[model samples]
Target: MSNGPTKRAADWAETTGFARLDAEAFPDFLPGWVWLVGAGPGAPGLMSLLCYHAMQQCDVVVYDALVNPDILRWVKVGAELEYAGKRGGKPSPTQRDITLRLIELAQAGKRVLRLKGGDPFMFGRGGEECQNLAGAGVPFRIVPGITAGVGGLAYAGMPATHRDTNHSVIFLTGHDASGKMPANVNWPAVAKASPVIVMYMAVKHLGEIAAALIAGGRKADDPVTIVSNASMPHQQVASTTLEQAGAFVAAQEPPTPAIVVVGHASDWRSVLDWYAPALRENPIG
Candidate 1:
């Protein structure tokens, strides 16, 4: 008969206001539960519709370091904004404390929003927070956003997956809570298996990570791309090799908020860099 899939999608779009949303698509109603939303890498526009909705409706927002401040401006007036950021070498709230705060707020019958940077589940400690909420019997919903591994890499002209170089990609964090190279990571195995590696919050441990990868049989000359403030107007990209990344980054006085990507996919950045065009049109700075 008629195109059933197309018809269904159209109906869904109309029902959810997806087809009619304009620049300001804030929700008019609030759910009687908590929402854990990913704000994407850095660009406020990269935030999902559900995230925007939650911001508009939530009574309080508990956010992380990477969440763009501009996005928070969208929160309704009188909404409480609590900072729960965890920088590598800075004094910040503990993960347990943040989780407990969410539970407390949700229990108070407030529409709680736990806003994070990038995908909540991608090394964002969203799993632990969700587990805590579940244990406290607090109902919650998750809103996925673009992760830095993909969005940040895209800004630097690197793709996580390429048909020619890599069919799969591995995402990992460079350091653990102790601010050291993660001992739990099987570097040798990852070096041998993953053709593409994307790391978040790895700038501080670049030297150790590079050595580990080199020791794991990865080439010292393997391509690498370091992106800082990715997807934002102040974005900077530094291209080098595994052996030189540490020194190269140290030499440059680049701004903070960075991610590191190592693999053949980084080579594709030279030809496929489109973020410049996007940035020229919408300057975040």
Candidate 2:
């Protein structure tokens, strides 16, 4: 029933090292249950082994827009692939419809995998989907994947937390349901909460966000780093300050699906940038 092509079991196993993994260590993908699995930030290689197990067992994969398409090559031979992706400013399936479809699929005794890019609980709406599943009495499990705020930043050589820089880090979203800056966020309090702040889905309102932070007692020249298309081949890293973030972003026009970090942690990127150099040295596969 798969609409997409699937690799031979032996070939895929050899390619992914699936054959060498201990099968008994992984739980069986049961029918009538849903697994909310994270596919990691952007790199297919970042996917967890358990996630790959689910990929091999699931009857259907309901994935997000941010999930790299290359990761889909792991799906089982007969499994179906469903695009339940939701992109900002683009035509997307309604949340209600997507949830309903999951319920419908599980009710039919299919092993369902709700695959998402980044950790599902980290602003990915995995919680809401689980709530709906619980209401419907659909058995479900959560498999946490690497969130972009942490994994993505690491790929850009920016640490979310460094003891010397700060004792705490805050992770927040840039927009609310209406697609504007989140009104409920206490910018002043957040400005003082931690020395490091990692924001997701913030590229659209980078200027306003930087302004609010600056107005809330954060230094205008505070270091900031934006990692776009993180962990992917075309990953981009942009460094700016709270004062010039708006203009810098406007002028440079960096790509979307970016993670914005505000604080001194970005300062370490000068020496920590390993991914870019690694890519450059081995440009050919």
Candidate 3:
């Protein structure tokens, strides 16, 4: 990795409130090296120090659709910010194309930052990006962030795992690359084993997925909550049972960009709810 900016370090660092961070400890984003970073679940406050520092130094940042645009304000001046964002049921850049762009930028001696929403490894296709980078012999670093499944749930006052609710939590995706229900999943097994179920991108197929879970032995009255626009100022939370979740969430305004949490732990949302008021009064600056 390169030793970072020479003359402008103090100016940018102090201005960004990043000068307090030790550069020696957190090296600058070097030219020709890509950093695959998670922007966390839609909240700038959830951004990690490493990811924030990388944003301050990167020359080109390729980001996903779910990443909050407000976070991009921190990127260094003159750096190219590319929207490589992919939204379900919408036209987006292909994975191969996105990876090739990263390679192209790095080869051109630009500090490439692949900024994704939530933890990149958690069904974010970050692993696929890393594989392509590795095969192309690109030097890169992975920076993890809070996933919507965990962090988003926290924002909605729903814990993924609680001693009374569950010991084992199941983290699964709602769809495959083709945007269909995942074929490999054994719904019955997941229904039987897991105490709490946290799903990503499940809103689209909530009806079918709910039926499968119900058929797999989950109770019809099981508490389920869908957290939409998670961790954002306009975030919304809707609750229903496993039997009615599909129809219940359909009534929600902005539905696709959501996280669905199932099992007993979801009940605590009413008691533990905190972000609702904060989002109303303060919002995130």
- Estimate the TM-score of every prediction: 0.88, 0.91, 0.90
For residues 5-38, write the lDDT of model 1, one tens digit per residue: 6655565666654455554435444444789999
- Candidate 2, residues 1-285: lDDT per residue as tens digits? 986655554455555544556534689889999999999997887888889999989999999999889899879999999999888899999999999999999999999999999999999999999999999999999999999999888888887888888889999999998789999999999998999999999988989999999889999989888999988878888898899999998999989899999999887888888786567343220
lDDT of candidate 3 over 1-285, digit per residue (tens): 667775556555565454545544677689999999998998888989899889888998999999899999989999998999888878999998999999999999999999999999999989998999999889999999999999998988888788887888999999998999998999999888887999999988888898999999999888888889998878888888899887876776446589988887777877988775646565452
The most accurate candidate by lDDT is: 2
Segments of candidate 3 deviating more than 4 angstroms: 1-19, 22-24, 278-280
Q: What shift in Å separates residue 136 of candidate 2 from its native position after superposition?
A: 0.2
Could you tell me how far off, in angstroms, the CA of residue 53 lies in candidate 3 after the best superposition? Answer: 0.7
TM-score for candidate 1, please give it: 0.88
Off by over 4 Å in 2: 1-18, 280-285
- Rank all candidate structures by their lDDT, best first, as comma-separated numbers: 2, 3, 1
Provide the global lDDT of candidate 3 against the true structure. 0.87
Cα error, residue 78 of model 1, in Å, equals: 2.2
- What global local distance difference test value does model 1 have? 0.85
With a 3 Å backbone cut-off (N, CA, C), the pairs that clash in candidate 1 are none
